[model samples]
Target: MGRRPRQGPPRPPAAPADIQLASDPQPDLEHEQTVEAAAYYDVDLTNRLAERVEFFQCRFKKATLAGSHLAKVRFTDCLVETSDLSNLRAEKGTLERVKLSDCRMTGLAWSDGLISDATFTDCKIDLTNWRFARFDVVTFEDCNLSGADFTDADLRGASFTGCDLSGAQFHNAKMAGTRFRTCELEGVGGIANWEGAIVHPDDLLGLSYVLAGALGIVVRETDR
Candidate 1:
């Protein structure tokens, strides 16, 4: 006999204060000196060196970090939601098991950085450079990555699902076991430099133009 279909769990009720605005406008960087597992909201941190800073189970919401250098910093079990990390440089920084949701990170460079089990959802990362960075088990879902550069980066087991990669460059990148599923490759360049990238067969449709351009051949349609 066949088994019955399983039912999912019931949904929770919506909160009443979902549309309420703050009265006093939350202060930025209230606990800059203190290092604790707390929520950091509405902060603007720039040109600061945060070394060996461990953010364990902390929340960084709507924060803006510009021109800051973070080295040996670890974001373990932390949530960075709706934050702007533009022009932020991170070298040898580690992001282990961190979640970055709905963040806008333009011009962000993470050279020689290490990212493991990091998840990026609905993030807009334009002009972001990740040269010589090592990424393992990283997932990028529904991210807008226009003009992003990943030159000479090591992307092992990195998955990009439903991401917009228009104008993104991946020159000389070592992408072993990299999966790009349902990604838009309009105007995306540097496909010839992918040494060992493992792309999905269905996603190979996006490389039609790139293959034709590489072989110097024109694809013309024939009408019946």
Candidate 2:
């Protein structure tokens, strides 16, 4: 068995697998609503209002979560495949042991969340708002994370593999134990904050200009 995701607290047991997906959003969702062990395919969760809900061991394939509002929600051991999460607003949520593959997460507002053991593979996560979030042992593989905001976030032990991080913001982000493998760092922000992070030698060459700027050095063409 693989290692478990870094979780803060233990959640309650999930329901049976035969649980049905919610067709309509609950007008007033209360505390600790559990939505686990279910599968939803090609459904629409637009304009939903869910708070403090738990989505455990659930799979959402080809679903649209446009304009959904989920605050302080918990998503553990869930798989979200080929889904449209554009304009989804989630704040202070918990995501552990979740795999979001082939998903469109543009303009997602997921600030101040706890993300661990999560893999965002083959996902379009451009312009996602993850500022002040805590990422522990998460991997972003084969994903387009352009313009994603990780400012002031804790990204220790996170891995970025084969991902396009162009124009991504990393201002003041904790970089200890962070690894970037075959990843694009074109125009990535906050170069001074990436001292402890690991990167390839070729990738470092690509960051020369940024590094020079961070060190207040001018790189001028020397006439031979």
Candidate 3:
């Protein structure tokens, strides 16, 4: 019998219409503050430092969170679009029911974070760090994830589609039920720990070579 096809994660719910528009041009975020049900646009929060902050049912459009350090933060039911989130470090953070689109997120580090029901689309997530993170029902589409590190991460509920995963590291990571489709898999590290992960048939040829290299197997032509 052939292998059974795996299903992708369910899509997250869209934002509610009742969310209020923020009267302020920018949000005044302090440590351990919880901001909810507000819509912000063009807020410049670059290089800000805060801890244990929470955002619920908030929408950020064209906001700049670049180089921010928001440790132990929580984000739920949020939509972030066209944001500059490069080099932002949000270690030990929690993200649930969130979606990010058309964002520049390169060099972002979310180590030891918990992410659930999140989707990232058309984002530049290259060179990011997700070490020791846990993902549940997370999906990435049309994203550039080259050189991202997933060492010791739990990716059971993660799926990638139309993404660039070149030079990504998955060393000692949990890969059960992880799915990849129409994604680049070149030079991906930690092929030895890819048990129970599903990939499209089109990507099998590249993945086979990666597996061979990990096993130290060389393919050579034989004379007839």
Candidate 4:
């Protein structure tokens, strides 16, 4: 008998039980007065701003940072897991070698930031904004990024695998050597905005729909 086709890679284990939010509450920035290297777990940090802060090897587990702003900050080797950062902003910041796993960051904005060698695994980044940011050698694996925006960003050597990017916008973005593997791109904007984008041939199938609209041609499939 022929060997069966192997299933896809095993999904990562779910986050810890304590990582779940008990209630949807706003995060309190006043409580985060200190910048020490301690564990920040199960805290609500919504609508807060942390400027000129530095977090060295800190762990932010199961915390909520909704509508928070973090500017001129640096997170070195941090582990951010199961955090909810919806509508959060991180501008003019640096995140080097950080791991953001199993986080819910819908509508999060990360403009004018530097994220080098960072990994985002199994995260929900729907409608997130990455305008004018710089990402060098970043990897996004098994993430949901529907309607996310990458306008005017520098995405050199970035890879997206098994991600959903429906209706995502990439207007005026510099996407040199970017790869998308097994990802969905339905209704994504900025089709003619590929100044220096390099996509896989299989992914170009999705672009055909956009190109057809640009060239004012109708595509009709025939029954085989």
Candidate 5:
């Protein structure tokens, strides 16, 4: 018998209580500092450097973490909205039960990271680096992931819907059971590694073109 069908929609992050807001609304994040049940709005953490910091049950709105080096940081049960995480380097970080919406994450580097039970919606994730990352129950919807790198990543539990993934690189990636729907697969790299991925019929044309290019097959229109 075939493998059991993967579960549907991932679990969302737990809602944080308003009463649990941090005493200092804009608390500084330090190395190994753990913050829970807090809300941060419009806080600028640009170019900050921290290691192994953790955030739980937290909400970040309009917060800017651009160019920050947050290596090995962990975020659990968190919601991030309208945040700018562009060019942030969080290598080997962990993200669990997190949801990010309307965030600008272009050039963000999450390589060697672990992301589980997370959802990214309407986010600009172009040129992001997810190399050597592992994803479980992660969903990306209506996100612009063009030119992103997923080399050596494990994506068996990931799904993309209505996402612009044009020119994305998937070399050496493990994609068994991965799902893609209404995604732009034109110019995607590593077509040979897509053996077990599930793609919507509507996306086959673009995927076929990419596959053909990889196989050195050329197609031409014929006059009727």
Candidate 6:
């Protein structure tokens, strides 16, 4: 008998109430502070270094985290929508039950991080690095992940639906129970090690061609 199907991504944490809003010239900017149930709008956090900062039930809208280093940071029940995360680096960071929608994540590096029960919807993740990262029940829905790197990442029980994963790398990754739904896998690497992964039958058409080329196999017609 085959293994049981993995469960879907866990639900996001509930939004907190009575959260304090950040005022102009935010004092918490670049400061190692714990802000809970807060909403930050249009904040400019460029090149900020946040170490051990924790944000719970927070919403960061149109905020910029470019070139920022977020080490050991925790974001729970947070909604980071329409935010710029370009060149953002997170080391040993954790994003649990968080949703990042419509966020620009190009060149973002989350290596050696823990991302559980997270949803990255409609985000641009091209050239993003997730090497050595561990993901559990994470979903990348309607996201552009072209040229993204997931080498040595543990992506068990993760799902990518309606995403453009062209030229993505999954070398040495743990892909147990991973699902690919309607994703563009053209030019993707490490397709040979997709054991226990689930894909639609139609997806095999594209994947087969890639694997065939890698193995130098030629297809010829023998019947008229």
lDDT of each: 0.71, 0.81, 0.89, 0.74, 0.91, 0.85
Better of 1 and 3 by TM-score: 3
Give the Cα-based TM-score of candidate 2 against the true structure. Answer: 0.86
Off by over 4 Å in 5: 1-6, 17-27, 222-224
Q: Which number leads on TM-score?
A: 5
**lDDT tens per residue, model 6, 16-74:** 86777777644444546788887788888888886888888998999888898888788
Query: Weakest 10 consecutive residues, lDDT, candidate 3?
Result: 1-10
Q: What digit string (tens of lDDT, one per residue) describes model 3 on residues 102-150?
A: 9999999999999888899999999999999988889999999999999
Each candidate: RMSD: 8.7, 4.9, 3.9, 8.8, 2.6, 3.2
Query: Which prediction has more favorable lDDT, 3 or 6?
Result: 3
**Tens digit of lDDT per residue, candidate 1, span 1-224?**
12221222211212222222222343333322334456667766666676666666667789777777766566676678999888887766777778888998888887778777788899988888877777777888999888888777776557788998888877777665677888887666677865556676877877778767777877789788
Q: Against the true structure, what is each candidate's TM-score?
A: 0.77, 0.86, 0.91, 0.79, 0.93, 0.90
Weakest 10 consecutive residues of candidate 2 by summed lDDT = 1-10
- Clashing pairs for model 3 are none
Candidate 4: global Cα-lDDT? 0.74
Deviation (Å) of 63 in candidate 2: 0.6
Tens-digit per-residue lDDT, 194-220, candidate 4: 655666678889877877876778889
The candidate that wins on lDDT is: 5
- Candidate 3 residue-wise lDDT at 32: 95
Worst 10 residues of 6 by lDDT: 1-10
Q: Which parts of model 3 are misplaced by more than 4 Å?
A: 1-8, 11-17, 23-26, 219-224
Q: Write the per-residue lDDT of candidate 2 for residues 1-224, one digit (tens) a residue.
A: 13233433223334345756656532334567887686778777777787888887887898887788989888888888999999888899988878888999999988999987778889999999999998877888899999999998888758888999989999998886688888888788988888678887767776777777778888889899
Measure candidate 1: CA RMSD: 8.7
| Candidate 5 per-residue lDDT over residues 1-224, each given as its tens digit | 23343577778888866525455645567999998887778777788898999998988899888999999999999999999999999999999999999999999999999998999999999999999998889999999999999999888889999999999999998888999999998899988888899999999998989988998988789779
Residue 149, model 1, lDDT: 81
In model 2, what lDDT does residue 144 have?
A: 96
